[model samples]
Target chain A: MDKKIKMRAEGVNFFYGRTQALKNVDILIHANQVTALIGPSGCGKSTFIRLFNRMNELVPDTSLSGNIYLDDLEINSAQIDPVEIRKRVGMVFQKPNPFPKSIFDNISYGLRVNGVRDANSIEERVEASLKKAAIWDEVKNRLNDSALKLSGGQQQRLCIARCLAVDTEVILFDEPCASLDPISTAKIEELILELKKDYTIVIVTHNMQQAARVSDYTGFFLLGELIEFGKTQDIFTAPQDKRTEAYITGRFG
Target chain B: MFTTLFFLGLIIFFVGVRGAKVISWEFLTQIPRCSMTQGGVAPAIVGTLYITLGAILFSLPLGVACAVYLCEYSPKGFMVNIIRISINNLAGVPSVVFGLFGLAVFVKFFGFGVSILSGSLTLGILALPLIISSTQEALLAVPQSIREASLSLGATKWETIKRIVLPAALPGILTGVILSIGRVAGETAPILFTAAAFYMRGYPKSVFSEVMALPYHIYALMTEGVHPDRQMAIAYGCSFILLFLVLSISGIAIIIRQKQRIQHG
Candidate 1:
């Protein structure tokens, strides 16, 4: 099988009502590599990541005038259902949002919604996904307990496990550890490194060190523009743009 | 002044303590007849049960659906604006006006004259706006992220609504249902206009059977009846029962809301 570019966003200009959030941004993401989007808050990195799966489409008064491609198919057209694209492209939010249900049910929710009704299959897949998320050991004994009873970090991992259970092809994580503690953040970074071996991962983070640690390629976003895009090492160590250089040096975010 | 305040407090406390202590298993399980002095509140109790049940069944689905549209699917425009205004007005409409409306519509047009159906429909309409507003509040309280998360999980908008949004809002929706039930139970104006018969000696035989609700009976007992002792007894008994039912339902709704708040917090 030939490997393909998993996602591509070209000349994507997005706006919230009259205010433009992204300005003619373009990028190509390949399969099985972690692409880290680093930018200051409100810099459109989150907006850019959301556009890949059309999750940005949900915001009221939000508009997009660009094309995003997934597996050679244009995702911006009516022929492509946003819901279907979202299935193939999963999203984990900044806040840990486990359903107010049991651990097993939280992980199995996506599968159940997709019409998987087999009890044994759902149970097996939930365990496997939780194991992959590295939360199986922590929550195995408490599968029947309410997911809300878990600690914050455990809840975030449960969210990751839930995404995996849906069998998503590409995972979009928008600041998955921003609300978590440093220990939880480190754990998620480690999981992202492990996750990239099997799934294509795109992440948005404000932390330069996180991008340096986990990403294969890093895209630096500044003032709604893609200022730099290259191998993570190059962007952090030998960036070719002054704006990118200035951003990485901590002078300005 | 201090003695007066203390004596007043003591009287109120005694009444509450006596009411609580006096309530036995029979208070719930027994069927009231002529009076406890003459009989208990059997007929009014039965009428309350049927009317409240009928109102809930009639209003819950319609109320929740309306709320879902207002909160989730509505475009911000003139029509939604009009609907919001009308619903608010309907909630504020005098219970007497609701009673007259019920008498004109359900009693006359539907031809279910002086019957349970008429009363239930009137109560349902009266309660609809409340449930719709409460449900809208509940739906609004659900984080938009949860809906987005579900939709992005390959679920269609309806699927997301049915699965995540509704489930998350279930306890909240039940809060609305409970509140509506509490309101309907205490409603006497609509019932009087639509279904209050002069005298009902037997249990209602069918949906169209004209029945005597507790409020109407209390009204009749107070206004015209010769048995002052028995009538006053009935009034105390019915008021105690009605007050208890209303408090319980409202308390349950508050608890459900509190639980949801705790989870979200």
Candidate 2:
């Protein structure tokens, strides 16, 4: 089967002041597929994902070298606005971070910022995005209630709905289920599978089985390096690198 | 904590007992007569209100803007540390020195004269450090995740600050403003050389008009008036009114914050 590349990172190196966070890494994310990055803590999976939407720029004294492209556009180029890049590539963080706003307003916040002004269209899109995230039925009755009042799982899904509201082509999930219960994590995994029909997805997780369960492609990161990248089944069953096999088999982090 | 509250209660009790008899409607609404031994402190009350309002008007927007620039826009480095140190030191500078600076700059250089504008400008400068530091803390208290969420949705830095950060930090900022209002309303030295008329008739007609203020009035009544006993009682009355004014302002801010908390939650 042939798959088109949605995003490509070529020889990317990231630095936080004097410390290196991501070192000489290269990967390709395919269209309409879920790519899972798995590693122990501080293995640079989160750092690598943030490069896609230029979130690293917000951190002072942090620098990056190399090319990251969305389609054919060099997203890191000086001419490309981070705001414009973020419109195309959205993100969901590990902890559920809904703005301290109403449930309806939380979803509409993205649309409003992206210049969706019509009240009717905003309401429709908010409804549609909520439905897509599998959270509409739970929150529809209390749309005006504060988003913070929702359970952790619902808030996470609402964040996903917020990302979806902006019509982003790619959605990056940085341990989206890290703070969730088992049931919530399962619901999110199911939702990610459902979402792969339209949006390209990249998820960073500490759980190896989660990567295997939800991803088409999987990359194993070890100490700021991409040790192996292949189809999820092949990476789990036949890792090309020794480090990948050891980490997957729980020999050591 | 008990000792602190005891002393606070004692001071309130002393002031209220000494001045409660003189705090009638006429005493609050009428101008002083017979060398300030009689009549009301209406002009002083009006002047304190105007000067406090003016200080807030000048400082609130500028202070919030400065804090946003420092916390959000400016890159953190040695220079930022230097700037922060300078601001902290500015807060430590004596109010009397600020009064002198106001005398030379606003009163002499700008020719604002010994007027309400000059006093307001001085008090505004006095309030800036408090407002800036508190606002910076408030901005910092807004979790970074919320900002990232907004930016990830294509909101610009300013947009995120305006919509997310500022609103989140507003309660804290208002608390700072309330504290500054109490400080500004009670300050005597900053207004001594810049404003605070020895005795004024009616009320201030404009910002350029010199006016009586409560603290300076109390000071003058206790030291300069002919009838010491009468003036001392009136001074206590002025102090009581000033305390009431500051508390009411803070009370309003507390009410606003409670409403905001309820709405956001």
Tens-place lDDT per residue, model 2, B1-265, is: 9999999899889988987878999999999998898899999999999998999999999999999999988877899999899999999999999999999999999999999999999999999999999899989989999999999999998889999889889888998899899889999999999999979878999999999999999999988968998899999999999988887887887887787678555
Model 1 lDDT on a 0 to 1 scale: 0.85
DockQ of each candidate's interface versus the true one? 0.72, 0.73
Q: Report the C-alpha lDDT of model 1 over A22-92, residue by residue, as the tens digit.
A: 99988989799999999888898998999988887788899998788998889889888887888889999
TM-score of each: 0.93, 0.95
What's the lDDT for all of these models? 0.85, 0.93
Scored against the true structure, residue A44 in model 1 reaches a CA lDDT of 89
lDDT of 2 by residue, A14-48 (tens): 99998999889999999999999998899999999
Tell me how far the alpha carbon of residue A104 in candidate 1 is from the true structure, in angstroms, after superposition: 1.4
Best by TM-score: 2
Worst 10 residues of 1 chain B by lDDT: B31-40
